[model samples]
Target: MNLGVLKDRIFGTAPTVALIVCAVMATDYLVNIVLLNTPNAYTPVSTLLIALVVAAPLSYWLTSQRQRLERLRDDLSASLDAKQEAIEEADRRRGEAEEAERLYRLLSDNLTDHVALWSPKGERVYSSPSIQRITGYTLDEFMALPPQAMVSEADFARVQKLIRGLTPGGPPATADYECTRKDGTLIWLESAYSLLGDGSGILLVTSRDITERKQLELDIAKALELAETASAAKSDFLANMTHELRTPLTAIIGFAEVLRRSRGLSQTAARQVGHILDASNTLLSVVNDVLDFSRLEAGGLELDPAPFDPAAMASSCAALVEERAVAKGLVIKVKASKGLRPMNLDGPRLSQVLLNFLSNAVKFTAHGSITVALSQKVEGDAALLRGAVTDTGIGIAPEHLDNIFDRFSQADAAVSRRFGGTGLGLAISRRIVERMEGQIGVDSVEGRGSTFWFEVRGPLAELAAPEEEAAPLLDGEGGVRLLLVEDNAVNRELIKTMLEPFGVDVETANDGVAGVEAMRQGHFDLVLMDVQMPVMDGLTATREIRAMEGARGAATPIVAMTANVLPEQIANCLAAGMDDHLGKPINPTKLLETVARWSGRTHTA
Candidate 1:
């Protein structure tokens, strides 16, 4: 409303007004002055006024419409950009989902284990392509069959119970089931069932074929059974053969011992009897070696630990070989560490090992000394006892040392022929050491000498009380009343002759049946029962005698005198109520001691 604002507004539209005026003047000139020859009706002012009226309204409307159109175009472009960005994001998400689907199919289709998905109602929802390979059925065919159709009748109930116990989010259940294929062939399947953890009550199952593994297990079981049978048969054969062999050796050695004790005999006859005794003893040693090796091989040589003096055992073994050493003009000595205490060890078995070492040393050494050394050391609540037999003569070669402890192996064929051994001594010794959880080896140089050594660990044990000296085998008042039950006539006679000299009143029985009748009819201080007899075996007769003496009569002591000396056979005799066991090829001293100990009286007059 001010003068300056009015002037500015009026001048701003002056150019539009001037241009319109010029256009109006030009039109008037063309129409009236040139063609009609008429004079202009208005001046420049009037034309200018006419032009301003039209230009002002038109410029105002056009400026307002241009701003509104620009704002509309900007809004449309912004909306289009946002839509394009949203479209791009959607495409990327779609690609990711499609790739994941492809991977899922790739793994499920290629797996060897059959996979299945089931709904809560037990309806099949999906099956992997591996179903055909596992069950010989296409996915569609498998889905059509009931779940029980594929499972064998024997396993279907178990499978149902497992499925019924499944819970969402619980641990998977696994079991082996026998299933039938489409062709009705039976196969084993180790299957796992897991309930889906999504709370949808869906089930997932996986299974793998195990038919070949099952068959392998069955074959292994059969092989083990056959091995056990063969082992038992070998044991029986060995027992029988030992009985047959020792039955004769008993008569040979027993009669020889009797002859050697005869009051009047020439030097030639006495020397000949000595030879027979030596030969028989050597054969007995070989038989013992064989039986021991068999026991070791069968994993049945258990250790019986008791308190024993290692040094005394070593000295005893050396003494047993003293005559042989002296005959060869070889000096022998026992070197025992002073103050070596008693230890819990298998004394008999340890003695066997020591004897084997000393025997070998005396056999191989020609003119040098043999020393048996025993030492002991303490190690943290346990003691290590070591026994070494060192000899100076022919030694083992280096290569032979590696396999010298192997069963039935010798230094060489020449050594075996010259030394005359069955090559089982060192092997048996090695096994004995191993069973004691100990070590055994030899230090030797081909011809200079050999030293055999063994180290065993055991706890310190209390020494047992000394035993009383055995009484003489004759009583002044009355002789021992003993029944000799033996099937072999020569063996019976040999035993009778051996005992009669000491005043034993021997009652003879041909078999176990007669022995049992003899026990029922007469009172004998002891009975010497031989196994493998006719009519009845020793074990059966002993059992009958024990049963008959139930709460009514005195239980007579019966000793098993047979070559059936295997540990099991000894156990059977004890189980049948025998008081003691005396293996065949019996020693006179052992027989005398056994009778005296059980009779509780001397027989010497």
Candidate 2:
């Protein structure tokens, strides 16, 4: 407490009390001198009375005054103490505020990030020294310019809009924009903003340069574009190569089958023929796997769904691998559930999937039985069909089962060597089943056996009648004329030889130009048209033939023969007015069936 004022006031009272006591002493001395001059008798009585009256009253007055002075001093000291405490508290708070401001400047001035404060009216109030480092401008230089000097014209409107949208004490907002540095170079910036208010409200902006990040993003985009282009180029190269490859494989397999069935061969020679047939078939599977995987990866193949007998589908696919199973000393069986029904499905693709499972079973099993079963349950007239191919062969290991459906993956490298395969059959089957909206999986015990299964949920519908196979025609059936239009000499000769056994008249045209000319002069039951040729392509020829309606034009059936098996390619063929299509490496059975289907000529070609 501050006692200076109260102490001074108390000391002044002490002097006044001393003066009052002196006045009383002076009066007593004067009265004693007067008594000496007057009569001695009067002096004793008058002096005694004077002493009682003056001394008593004067003492009482002095005591009362002293007490009042003491009380006044106490009150003044309390008031002084309260005023002193207020002054000290104010000084401490000011020191703390100054220290806080010093610390804030210390951190922000050293930052790499740009920091700035603006008044509520959008005028710059404060800018950290870091702004000079980022923009190459001195503090005075920047402060001398207009508020919008550093802002980009392109982003000017957006910046104003964002600032105007901010609310006091609301969550911070972030923005990215372009700005000009002092050197006139444009740079990108991402900034976080908040409206700050500490009595005086202001806006705070913290920004970081993002020019490097933007450039990196651009570089990545360009690289991805180039990669996509390369991927597409690879797909095209593989597609063209596959077409060329299939052409020769068709001839190899076709001739081998004919040779294997030759008349009067010795047993040893027949066995040698069997080996050639088996090897050719194996090569064909490998080629098919590579091509199919390519198509699936490119998403060029699509499922064609239709109503097919579930039981018949399973039986037919099982039949494909039955001979191989029997040769391996394995028994094969087919089973259908009691209430199995025809379901809408991609018949050819489903059969291909089932064939993959059954063939794998046959190849792996040696002495045990292979069973193919189709179980079904009805759901409101639609049915859920589950097809399973179980083989009593060496089972897959537990660890390998997880990745079994991955492309080009096998149980192990040794298993791949022991079991000769391209390792793509299961992968292809999985893709086919998944694209059909079905699920496929496997269950097995090591050293026991394995069961591969698939389930398809679809509605029951009327199954189309099975297509009749191409049978050798008798002479009495009347000769049906066929115009075979192909560009390759080898293919022409092979087709002619393949069709010789059937009692049909066959004529050849070198290309579409010749085929069109030939068709005008001849009445043909069917025209086997190839897509690519010299002079004119098959699509143009077919359209041109349709244009001619005189002798053998619109009424004659035209079937496309080519190795372009993509659905889009087939669609293009049909869009060009061809009635049907057949992909190569042509199955002899399919070739004959296709011929019989359209031409009504039961010739095995």
Which numbered prediction scores highest in TM-score against the true structure?
1
Which 10-residue window of candidate 2 scores lowest in summed lDDT?
596-605
Per model, how many backbone clashes are there? Answer: 6, 0
Q: Give each model a TM-score.
A: 0.81, 0.66
Against the unseen true structure, what C-alpha lDDT does each candidate score?
Answer: 0.87, 0.80
Which candidate has the highest lDDT of all? 1
The C-alpha stretches of model 1 lying farther than 4 A from their native spots are: 1-86, 263-266, 378-382, 469-478, 600-605
lDDT of 2 by residue, 1-605 (tens): 25865565455455555555556555655665564554333444455566556655565556557767887899889888988988888888888888998998888788889888888887889887887887788888877778678786767778778878888888888888877899999888888888875646799999888889977887999998998898778877776776787778777777766677778788888888888879878987888899888888877667777888888888888778878888899998998888677888788888988999998888777678999999988899777889999999888999999998899988899889998898999999999989988999999887778999999888888866776655443343436678999898778877776666765567999899999999888778889998878899999999888778534323577899887766667898999878899987777777766765656432221
Name the lDDT value of residue 401 in candidate 1.
93
Model 2 residue 193 lDDT? Answer: 84
In candidate 1, what are the lDDT values of residues 1-605, reduced to their tens digit? Answer: 58965565556556655666678778767776778777755355676677668777765555446556776899888889888988988898888889988998998888899888899998999899999989999888888999899876768888878989998989999999788898999998998999999998999999999899988987999998998888878988988888888999999988999999997889999999989988888999999999899889888899999999888898789889999899899999999999899899898999999999999999999997999999999887679999999999899999999999998898999989898989999999999999999999999998899999999999988886897865555544438899999999998888888787677889999999999999889888889999888899988999898888875646877889998898889999988888889998989989888888776432221
